[model samples]
Target chain A: MPEITYRDAVQKAIADEMRLDDSIVFFGEDVAKAGGVFKVTPGIYEEFGAERVRDTPISEQAIIGTALGAAITGLRPIAELMFADFIPVAMDQIVNQVAKYRFMSGGQFTVPLTIRAAQGGGGGFGTQHSQCAESWLMNFPGLKVVAPATPLDMYSLLRAAIRDDNPVVVLEHKYLYTLKGEVPADASPGSIGEAKVVREGADLTVVALQLMLHRALEVADKLADEGINLEVIDLRAVAPLDSETILRSVMKTNRLLMVEESPRQGGWGASVASMIADRGIYHLDAPIKRVNMENSLIAYSPVLEDEIIPNAGKIEKAVRDLLAED
Target chain B: MTTDSIARLDRDARLKALNTMTTIRLAEEEIQNLFMANLVRGTTHLAIGQEACSAGVAQALRPGDSMTCTYRGHGHALALGMTLRAMMAEMMGKASGACKGRGGSMHMTDQSIGLLGANAIVGAQLPIAMGAALTAQIKGSGAIAVVFFGDGATNIGVFHESLNMASVWKLPVLFICENNLYGEYSPVRATTPIDDLAERAAAYGMPGVIVDGQDIEAVYSATLAAAERARAGDGPSLLELKTYRYRGHSRADTGPYRAPGELDEWLKRDPIDLLLGRMIAAGEIDQAEYDEMRGAIEKAVVEAIEWAQAEPFPELEAADDYVYYPG
Candidate 1:
């Protein structure tokens, strides 16, 4: 009934879940009085008291470790690491402990925790503050990684991650927080490991994750003017990849193009490409092309940063090259 | 509160404490033999001289309360009522083990017994214990979480984070640090600037108590008070058990770091012997009864080792089986 911004949708999802479940709590540096650096947690402390909406000390290791501890014990804690770049300090907890607890315990335990942080670079935050680490987390076995690009996806995915039994890493694009989209009034929280086909076409399938999905959609619209139809698939979740949906699309289009904001080497796009090559290689008429960030640190300068990341223009050109091949 | 209270314990509680310590001692002896005989694989950290802390604390806990332990966790697991057979089987990598042989000696766990796990990483269990306490608080289960770590863990950042959160939320947790004075090859003096680990708790605005870890009665009394305060929701307590480890940090360690006379000094204060002396002096048990208890525990330990050696290793294909991806 009402159009909400992506930031508001995230806040509403946490507020609603906190209302429904007393075990749900939020904690991060500056999250309490500041309501999050991006304001995604505004009014949460006022609504849920200080205990539920905790403001933790400036320790990423503790932020993640405390969340893991709280999650495994009983409470559902959504811990925010102020920025995605700061996650390296807590990688041991996220990768070794939180990700391996279920498997290590032979399914005897579950780490029902959610780690939310803003990712991506567009606001000239420099190399240290701007990073997309979803691919790094996807390498682990017991973790579920998600990055929501739209208001609807953000709300539904955040809610799903909070409710899931396994540990989840929700990478919210810092640049997309203010973007608005139409969300259904009564839309139920969506499932993990499913891809959403935002635009349908017959020529080629362009798979994108997080904010790149919006760029892919924009490129799909531009390519339509030239009578070149393109199918845009949004990879809502990374770890439990929707291989079936991706294969089905690849079988129809016979060409694949994956775009990601992470480094090209060992990026999540590599996994998708390898999956298609392994399962649906015979369905392809041309090679699968990937558009990703350069395999280097993000530059501090805006011009250099822009050149490092993949944009709609690059996705469009990659699709055209793949289609041009006989 | 009084010296008489320090010297006195209920008959059943004293027996339970002694039995727990005996179980852990025998279990460690069995594990050592099995490890040397090549029946069990992987590194092992034995809690031989540090039995009092685990036994005393575990004896104070109810069935529903939970515990998180460090690599030196055989005592913790055995004290929490995890069958010696399961623990031995786990070390031997058998499917009959508590974690279905997925976890080894340092990772032993029995959720049914409220033993969350024996984490290998130092100081890693602090936050986890806090989380479990948070769970207990939220569910109103009246349960508490006891975290067992070493003096070495005090230097780790997770230790501070866990303490801060535990005190801030007043979560039902008992942060027990077994200050054995050594963190692997390095002694605590070489690593930390503080003389007393208990004093560090004062920074977090909670009560910190240091007790004679080699005395079972002292450890039991201190832990009981801490557990009672936790259950009453008074807040978390930091109990520093001043103890010593008879063995090296791990199997690979030769323990050359200790002075020549330190081991003998600690052996004089053996917790099991102290408990036995008290029991005998009070006429709680005769020499014959003590011999029978010791014999039974020895028999159990022998059977556990035999069972573990007879067990088979897990199949290689099973390695990737439990990597969960909830579709």
Candidate 2:
């Protein structure tokens, strides 16, 4: 096993794929000369040169739109959007053009393009800079949405996304860029629609994503002596959700707590909660609980940000309440 | 349009251009009739009066060149030599359609003919065309992608963004803006600064060309020059064709927003009439030949309609197919 940063894992995935196929290329705001804003793609420029690794203008629409067109004509393009919030600027291309082209073109074209964006609130960036756009992207059919929480997951899922014939959006959390973990020497490429049970238990099931997954695990570790056995499920790919895995856990544990960083309403957390009630309600012994942001904006101040964004305390409290109710 | 280009056209080339213009004109007219009779399932933006632009540019393109256009792109598709039967079937939502009934009029595509698509979203295909050109540039394919859009589409963010990026990257692309005086119902004057839409190309450090949409020869010359420049690695060019569409925007609304006698004024410069008159005056095509060509087109369109009508509807369960590969 080799310890690697999540940032390196993503860069390696792109670099490795580009080496395998000359048709693979990437371009975005600062991906070439300056690597990337978050330094996720730092050495890609020196390695791939300017032709394969390009630095585009400050036009998200053109970045994604050109990739869609290039993908149509025998090229695999990886478009890096600086931040997820800026996705709306290219919504027409992403939603209408990129998502529907496969179905609309009647399979005449396969979009082997990967759209990467850094999302989630942590760096005190304003509202425009930070946003988890999984829900909005998941709404569009013919799009594969995958958010990896660990370095290994980042490398493996990115490979899966690059190989998938459909258009894939890889949402990487801003906070997890530098997170270090032990990734196998040849990290096994992951399937996009699969989920992982990072920690096992039979008492309660806790489903979380990105930074929320870390918080759920932290709470699970602290509650071990308190007789709380928490089963932690990491939702790697939110779209084409690994529902069978979550449902199987719910059927055994009977209690579920879902955590998310986006706004409470219409967020991924709401979808998970609905999925449990819609299908797994019969096996539940307690009500499904969701610890989410209080339906408010992620403010700049550390105090206000901490209040809105869920944390280990919130997950622990939610788990205690779900257990005390019985 | 310079009369020199039309005069320079040899007899055969002149007749072929006229044939293309007439086919586009008749096809759009037939689509209108079909829509009125409820034979076509969805609405279509007719390119009746703007046939010259599609005919000229598409004819100018080499066999390897790529093209994409707006929703009002039946003329462009026909000009690219796509089978009228396939296009008609697509618009009618038949199983034998170009896209197998999944994409209606707005999203018609056939990669075999190098026609990427006719997108419904305004200005959406500009960047895609840029990408195609980029791919060609990277692969040294020596192919150029000509994207056809309208005046209204120019106001979109992607239009300007794509132009700037294409010019900056020196991608092999030609942008064709068919200024048909309106974006749907709103006249171009109200929506855009109509003085020199082509001048925007200068901002991106590329050449801007303005031509008469009613003049097929003028359009062919301008597009041929642009495509040549792009293939030579001189970068993209913007060509704004000043034309007009006689019909309203689409099938649903009867366009009543025109100025008094506006339709009549534009109708005088219809491309089909312009080409027919020029070719007839030059003895390249006689009255007898023109009548035979038009009669042949009419007969072919009837056969296409008959084929489409006889084609079975796609299976109901097939709607779920192709949402993803091997789904």
Candidate 3:
């Protein structure tokens, strides 16, 4: 067992997989010599050398397309975008070329590429750099989207994403990079589309992911002392959602409250709420409530950023309001 | 009109090259007839006049080498050795088609022949080809990646990004731009500022050459030289083929926007006819042999259409297949 930061977990997962598989190559801006702009992947280049771990120009489209090209031709490539907001810059390569290549080619090809991008708002990276863009990619059927909230989940889920035959987008919350947790040496490469019940309680089921998961957990802890029991589930996989776990939890708790840092409209929470309404509507004792960021550009000020995005207070209020419902 | 390049090809090589160009020409013509008959569901882009570019480039590369072309890729797929039956079946959306009817005219693919895939989006294949080259570089596979696009694709941001990255990494790739004088309806001049699209290669620090696309020998020679350089680990190069499209952008476009004599002017330098004239001038074959070869090819193409049309459409449930690999 090792206590490691989420950032180190990502680096270690990539390094460990690259050692076992020569087919795995890492490419991104300043990821090699400069050790990544986030400093998350520093020693990989030294360990694997320039061929396995390489730096790329600031061309997001080329970075993604090259990863795709390499993936289809018998190599598993891991591409890192410096920021999630920049996902739009390479949207065509991701949504059209990478996502559709397998289906478009009638399964003649496989794009086993893992695209890692630092996402979420809190450190004041401004509108262009800070966006929880996991929802943007969930709309596509061929793509798998995962957001890891803890170091252990980050390590295990990323390894799973790399090993996946389909293209997987891993959104690492920027604020959680330094947050540390005990990660098992042989953390199982758990399957995607699986949710982790971080805390189990009886009163209500609180679903969240990435930074919002941490916030909801904190809210659940505070409310637990106040005689309110909350079952908090960390939705690690956003696409092909772990709806069974959610519906089962909703069945028990009879209430569902989703917390997310993305825009309210078309957010991950919105999609989950719609699904719950469709599948588990009769089981829910109250209307499904969502705590999401306002549909506005993330601002530079920390106050405005937190004000817009979900916080522990918002999660707590939503939880209490759901319980107070007749 | 005899150059040292055409002389390099012996009588058999010359006739084979002519046959490839003619096959592509006849196949494209047949596809047009299929479209007119309402057999092809969506639109199709026919490379009727750009056969030399496809034939020349395919001849230059080894069989294991990879290639990707634009939506107007019927010529490239045929040149790369995809069966006429598969191409025709794909156009007709039959289960026996190249992509098993999952992909239509725009997304034709035959992985067996190393035709990576044909992309419908403009300039989308550039990075994918670079990636394939990256794979070759990593595996030390000696294989190269060739990507073809229209002159309009050169203006795309990804096109520039792919070239810069490929050149920076010394990836084994050939960026072939078929400057067919138009990117859809607009002529190159109306859309692009530069006269020669190959000049864009200098910014990426790669050797960029312009070839007379109608001349199959010239295209083959230039591509072979570039491929050799790539195999030697020199880097990527951009090849601009000065060619034209006989038809409009897609099936419905009648080229009303083109200059009146533009189609006629390009037809005068038809790729298949240019190679045929070269072979005939060198006494490779007489007009009778050429006619007989074309007739046989036309007959084969017609039969392929019949076979493809007879094939069944894919099961409706197949839409869910291959979205993700079970593996």
Using lDDT, give the best candidate's number.
3
* Tens digit per residue, CA lDDT, model 3, B126-241: 99999899999999999999999999898899998999999999999999999999989898899888999889989999999988999888898899989999999999999999
Where does candidate 1 stray beyond 4 Å?
A: B1-7, B308-321, B325-327
- lDDT measured at residue A135 in model 2 versus the true structure, 0 to 100: 77
The list of candidate 2 runs beyond 4 A from truth reads B1-7
- Please list all clashing residue pairs in model 2, or write none if there are none: none
TM-score of every candidate relative to the true structure: 0.95, 0.98, 0.98
Sort the candidates on TM-score, descending order. Answer: 3, 2, 1
DockQ of 3: 0.86
DockQ of 2: 0.75
**Candidate 3 stretches greater than 4 Å from native:** B1-7
lDDT of 2 by residue, A86-195 (tens): 98989999999999888887778888999999999887886788778887888888888999999999999998898888899999999899899988877767899888
- At residue A115, candidate 3 shows an lDDT of 97
Candidate 2, residues B1-327, lDDT tens digits: the string is 355654346778878888888888887788889989998766888988898899899878888788988999888888998788998898888888888888988887989988899999999999998888889999999999999999998898888899999998999999999998888889888878756789888889999988988888889888988888999999999999999888889998778898899889988888888878877888788889899999999899889988998999899988877777753
Give DockQ per model, in order: 0.61, 0.75, 0.86
TM-score of chain A of each: 0.98, 0.98, 0.98
Interface RMSD of each: 1.8, 1.2, 0.7
